[model samples]
Target chain A: MNSSHLSLGDSEIRIRMLSQVYSASYLTRKKEREEKSKLLEQLYVHDVYDRIASDFEEQQYQPWPKVKDFLLGLESGSLVADVGCGNGHYLNVNPNISVIGVDRSFNLLRAAESRVPGVNCRADCVALPFRDNQFDAVLFIGVMHHLVSSERQVKALLELSRILRPGGTILLYTWAYEQQKRKFNGQDLLVPRYPSVGEDNPHCNCHRPTTKSSGDQLLTLPNQSQLSVLDKLERIFVRPFNLFINLFKLNSHGDSIETGESKDYINSVPSTQSDTLDDKSINLITKCSNSIYSNTLSHSDYHYDSMILVPKEFRVREFPASSLFSVSKVLNGKVSVHKRDCVSHSTNPARSRDDRFYHVFKRGELENLIKSSKSNLVVSKCYYTSGYWCATITKNTL
Target chain B: MKILTHNMLTSNIIKSVKDGYPLKIAATEVQEVDVDFNPEFIQRLLAKLNWSVICEAITQLDATKDIELPENLTDEVKEDEDMLRKIHHVLLEVEVIEGKLICPETGREFPINKGIPNMLLNDEEV
Candidate 1:
């Protein structure tokens, strides 16, 4: 056969046909979809922040003590940059050092400006305007988790490293998915925004309207008094079942010793918030109602009133702490993702749904991130305080 | 935004811009505010600064007369209290109230209004 004719043989034709079927257009569309999703996620984050700006500002009145301590430790007259400086509470913490605050929200920047005029700027954390190596100290407290994607989180850290001078200190804080106090579902969550009575319902004390059945609303009430005799009986059966599940979990996992310890820690805490068992029992009852109470109550009614107070519009992303390991494998030894609690069992009815997406950090996630970035940052101190994983890292002089 | 901060900032954060550093400054209004003079802080900062870039930035602002810094740091210069104060003034006191930071590579202009530089880029730029 001639060389040209042989080249167009059966295998070549088949390969050509396969290439034609899955061509450049398919790959391009996939890329476009990814870009669109990222854009949508960014918009969602910004929209939620803008909507909750006022209430969020109110909630962030006090800077966490550990963050304050980090700020106070900076040398007098040192230049400091507070990335995601919500309401500029930390900017005003020390007058000795010059702190320039940057945040994505204009309203939050305005709030910060009101506290310390001319020191606040509206800027995204990913692209700060300040020159490289400008800041002697940089603060990324409660900010890293807000960057939904691992790529953005790493990019932000690199950007931070770029802006900080070698030997300069960086203080970082983020919510830990492995906290002893709280539990969560998936890392990415859309937490509900419960409106105050005046905002959602002007005439009544209850934020939600009372148009639903009184019996439905009664069951949803967190108070024990509102629980019907049937719910009380269900709770009795569900509690032991929850303990059994806990025991099962302990037996299955090698790390059950630590889980048992945290369970005990939760049990010892006397606050109403510590009644995580009740949350588990309630969820169990809701789940097993078909088999346990087939004739007693309708399953649909149990779910309907439970989420009445949850606003449909507002949602926040919760990122899983475990995902950090995949994002930066070099951090594997330093950080460990621990399952502390389940979201459905949260004592706070508002928090039960895990509406907020939290990228909870393991204890040393920040240190690992810095290390993985290969930046000059060396972890000077790392510890958990005030329900946050905080670390103070200093840029190393190499 | 202080010229000191301007000195460190670059518009190259976007993927399209390769060499975003040394952004040309077009300042309509410049202000000099009195900050506490700390020689020690200035000395520490000098090590991190790009002296040649700072000099070029000073020329762009036409404020070379206001602040004079040497091109290189020597042991004597570090101890010179006068030079440290001058460096301190140039770094912290000279604020660009209104200006446009033009990216060297992409020619993208980031506006600075009321001393806050808006470094945010469009999605395409990102």
Candidate 2:
């Protein structure tokens, strides 16, 4: 993973070649600035899956129908390699075609072995164990983005082309940065993960002080600005005393609050704090008081203990298909880049939350990517299905 | 790994290993599993294969006892069903369960365990 091992000549050429795919400015963005921490980022990306391999496998039993259809369309007995094949979900897509699944996670591969006994290889996509021009078709589904840099992504694509026979087909699935349902702050983000508490607590209710869910309770508090001079003067002296009384009331009725029967008491406490504060200050005070109350009550039979956020990070990159135009240029205009709008196929809600960066494709982005690459690979068919931008490209027979 | 997969792999991925192709197979265990025959698929696959390299690999694995393949594929041989089956057997059915794929130029041996070939190179090699 270190650049020092690469020969100076090889590294120079690779950097030059990759520069054609990524502009100098684009390359410097987060990855280079944080070069010292790159190893940590990689560990986060790989270790998160290792930790959650079981939960991830459970949510991925259903394969994307479009991908299944593509596999079925291939000629019988075709040798296919599914790079980044998590749990071998696509291995059984067609009994006629032979599939060799490869992944970096051993735990995920173990799950795949239980489902499909043979043909799973533990390998990285950057340097696959398979021979050159070996497969009739290759799949790079949900795999490229995991590579931390554009250079690695290009290298992976080249590796795919290296193994693929001339005139062979490649089925690629990548998360798009642009989607209809969600918005992103940047192309690179470290998505936060929250532990899942099954249907017993369907709402995932936790004490999120900033969320709008508690707006009603916040509105019940009094605004200090609304008080007259005499009232304000009296309130300053009474505020501390009221806070103590409220804390006593909360402890006395902790059981009632746990059962959702003490809304009246909870609302009353905020009203006392609101008397000496403006609306904004009242909100701050209410948040502080709630955290204190929740902390103390949580120790005693509260159901919110499971809501603690897990200290794990999943690093993800969202690529704007348009940005790949430069990369397509490096491929001699044989590859084209496109943007497509599609729903994300990730079933794990924790992985798809706002904190997680996703590059949801806008409609036609995938096709544009292939076309813009100007590579020999032509888009034979491209479409959106099962919440993914799916495209099948074939190397033109020269 | 099947000989067909071996036919497509090269150890030249690392700059140090030049001409790392046509790896000499030293298989300790070879298994022949039945696979559905598709004449058209084999015919298409034959064009992409390096016949001499494959022949050399077959010989190295000591699997030439039952199968006798010509040095080069010809038009008439393409029409021969028996020849095609033999070719198919050597390519897809013959699996090297345990062995080493020695690089022709560098003489570096990549180990194969339980039918999976580990083509990963060292850090400096990459």
- Say which candidate scores most in lDDT: 1
Off by over 4 Å in 1: A1-37, A50-60, A75-80, A92-100, A110-123, A128-137, A162-169, A179-182, A192-357, A362-382, A392-398, B62-86
Tens digits of per-residue lDDT, candidate 1, B1-126, equal 666666567776778877588889888888877878877767766665677887788887865455666777788988998887877777777877778889988889888777666777787787
List, residue by residue over A13-97, the lDDT tens digit for candidate 1: 6665555544444345435533643553454455555555676444324456557777788776678889988777887787667
Candidate number with greatest DockQ: 1
Evaluate model 1 with DockQ and give the value: 0.32
| Poorest 10 consecutive residues by lDDT, candidate 2 chain A | A205-214
| Interface RMSD, prediction 1 | 3.2
lDDT (10s digit) by residue, model 2, range B10-115: 7777677656778788888887778778787788667766788778777776665556788778998888999899888887777777888888888888887766
Residue-level lDDT of model 2, residues A1-398, one tens digit each, is 57666675796667665655444343344233234233322454556666666765443234654577889998866889998887778877887677888776667766765565446666668777657667899987876545544335445666777778789989986653322222222233333343331223221211111112111111111122212422542343223222211111112212322233223121111112211223343234334433433322111121111221111122121221112112232223443322210112133433322222223333344443343334567777654432344567787776
What TM-score against the true fold does each predicted structure earn?
0.58, 0.55
For residue B86, give model 2's deviation from the true position in Å: 3.2
Clashes (backbone N, CA, C under 3 Å), per candidate, total 22, 43
**Candidate 2 positional error at B20, Å:** 1.7
